[model samples]
Target: MPHTDTPPSGHATDLALLLTLSTLWGASYTFIRIGVETIPPLTFIAARTLIAATLLLLWMRSRNVRMPRDRRVWMRFGVQALLNSVVPFTLIAWAERSVGASLATILNSTSPVMVFVATAFITRHEPVSLRKLIGVIAGFVGTCLVIGPSALDGLGGQLVPQLAIVAATACYAGAAIYGRSFKGLHPAAPATGSLLVGALVLTPASLLVDHPWALQPSVRSLMALVALAAFSTALAFAIYFRLIQTLGAIGTTAQAYLRVPIGVAIGVVFLGESLPSSAWIGLASVVVGVAAMSMPGSAIQVRRV
Candidate 1:
């Protein structure tokens, strides 16, 4: 496949999809935080995947889209599900036990940086250039500034949870790269299949560990779980696969850069949270970095000797 150093043009629809995805996923942090307060991580993740799988499967059936019968394809979907949904969801849910939603959102925004590094070093699926390198660096620095130094007060003690979030983001990057294999398949097919696999794996674990049947979850937590599954997992996957097909892995993962600001705004309005002046400045830097990274190489001029 021919590679473009940056995202392709004429992507108004893709850009809209990116924003929609960012909003859906940005709100997920809040949902996860709320749900995890009452629901154990494994149980919460299992419920999320099962609900999302049910919704997506119903949509696929309504659309008359036939499920792929190939066993090999299903196997691939299993891998994608583990990386994209199961692992990351559980890790983030667990991490939220010790971290605030806004902090977790800022940390998880590292997904784009992970995607760039994995593409450049491990997969070699895209060309690595100075522009992208600088963009990634700027985005990371901006994220740090957004979180501010005070957020790091517990860094030494909460290292484990923080590392879990970082690992989860890395899994997301890997899943984005691996997901390109499903390009020829309908977006809904893989989305539904992956969720199904995720649910299958998580159900047993949740039963054994959390024994969700015995616990009494609050109505608020239940509603949060529903929203997380329906919007963040099901609908988000559909948009995600479409973006991967149109934007490729690196471009698709760029939504993470946008998620930080959106997540913070959602927190402020809905959760009565507040951000410092530095966060606004950092958000501006993130926007500039993402814009620079998304531009085509030809759009940036160089003088020849």
Candidate 2:
């Protein structure tokens, strides 16, 4: 899956895995929509993280992966939990409640642009270039298009939700930058560690704020929650980290451009939602922008080892 100048056959297989990852992840929004109907948002998120954390812990134990004994590394894991899991997980769930899955995933595609912008400020050594800036502008325009004209129906009413999605993207960007600290840790160790922290932080909040014990979720919703936990959270991370290792970050993020279509497909097929023509246009713009930002040699000098 590593990116190569000569273009190996693994490129094709990596593309296939990326497509599959997008499909699985895109379907998550629908599952969230269905599951949230029966479970409170906080409860749903907390439960999913807990289940995923438990599974990851068990897997790590089976693999003989030792937890980081250093408090600094554990603190880094906590930061990762916040930026990667807690904040974005809550924001996207909240946004999905209002914007629906297709649009939400489109919004999520803005991560690359967000990362570019963040890198401009966060890493002084790697400033944003004019081309990257154009991609950022195009990504925002595409986001606006996806939201459609009716987005302004109320006086600044749509601002919060739109901003929430943006905040989610910011969280992802921050996670990507912050996760550089974990480059030394085994992938599963950090992955499991952060999920544990996420569960610890979120569970008490879910209990105190939502009181999920008092309200019962339907069986269908429970199943959806389990699927989201097992497939979307745990399995997705497994595949994602593997892809990141095998293909590198740029190559893995190339898959972001593909997520929009798969998101739309799952939204239409399962949720019976249709997108506006403008949304499709927006998606096209996003694809172009992401492709620009992710082009080999545009930023990183990735090499297959």
Candidate 3:
């Protein structure tokens, strides 16, 4: 199904939307931090996908958009769920148990770089240029700085959790590349379908491992879970679709870097978390790199929906 939105008012409105989307996504790390404190990662992510998927279905229904019934498209959605939601969502939830939201913000902000690497080397689905190459190098150096000696100190400890966040970022990159397969889909379709698939994949494992029925989650955790699913996952997808149409793919990607500072600020203000000086420097590098990668005419715009 398809429909048209009234033309956006102007750049200011677009900017507001950009900020809103960033704020919503930025707050997600903190939500995960709070929720996972009481809810086990598996059960928490399962519930998240369940809530988000249901909301996305309602969103689609409101838009008069019907999900694809093709079995093959659904199978593709299953693979997308594995990459976009199931694995990465679980990894981030598990990682946040030890890693702070600020670090996760910086570490997870490198998806464009990851997407570029995958596209350039493996897929070659898009052209590469000097500017984007520079962006890649800058992001790589920043990622190494964020992950290497100063932060790691050793192989174990926070290092494994940090690496897990990076791995989750990689999974998102893979999802972006594969998402192009749904080129003709209503934006709501892939989002709703993938989330539904994610819920299906995670629910059984969560039941077996966590036995959520026996868990006693606090009010703060439960509220955080609701916020995480409603605002961060579901509402963010709605905003993403709006931006994709109004701002074009490249313009919407500005959120990639913008959310870094926003996420860090949210962590500090709400969660009382802080990052080391080296991580700060790495964060700056990542912001610059992502901005460079997100510039006009990059040919690597990755639409999350």
Q: How large is the C-alpha RMSD of every model relative to the true structure?
A: 4.6, 5.7, 5.0
lDDT of 2: 0.69
Q: What is the TM-score of each candidate against the true structure?
A: 0.90, 0.78, 0.79
lDDT of candidate 1 over 177-214, digit per residue (tens): 99898867878888899999999999999999988999
Report how far off residue 151 is in candidate 2 (Å).
7.3
lDDT of each: 0.82, 0.69, 0.74
lDDT for 254 (candidate 1)? 73
What value of lDDT does candidate 3 attain over all alpha carbons?
Answer: 0.74
* TM-score: the better of candidates 2 and 3: 3
The TM-score of candidate 2 is: 0.78
lDDT of 2 by residue, 75-144 (tens): 9889989988898888877776777444565567667666665566555324345655565666556655
Q: Which stretches of candidate 1 lie over 4 Å from their true place?
A: 1-10, 296-305
Question: What's the lDDT for candidate 1?
Answer: 0.82
Clash pairs for candidate 3: none
Q: Which of candidates 1 and 2 reaches a greater lDDT?
A: 1
Off by over 4 Å in 3: 1-19, 136-156, 239-256, 267-288, 298-305
Residue 178, candidate 3: Cα error in Å is 1.1
Query: Model 1: what TM-score?
Result: 0.90
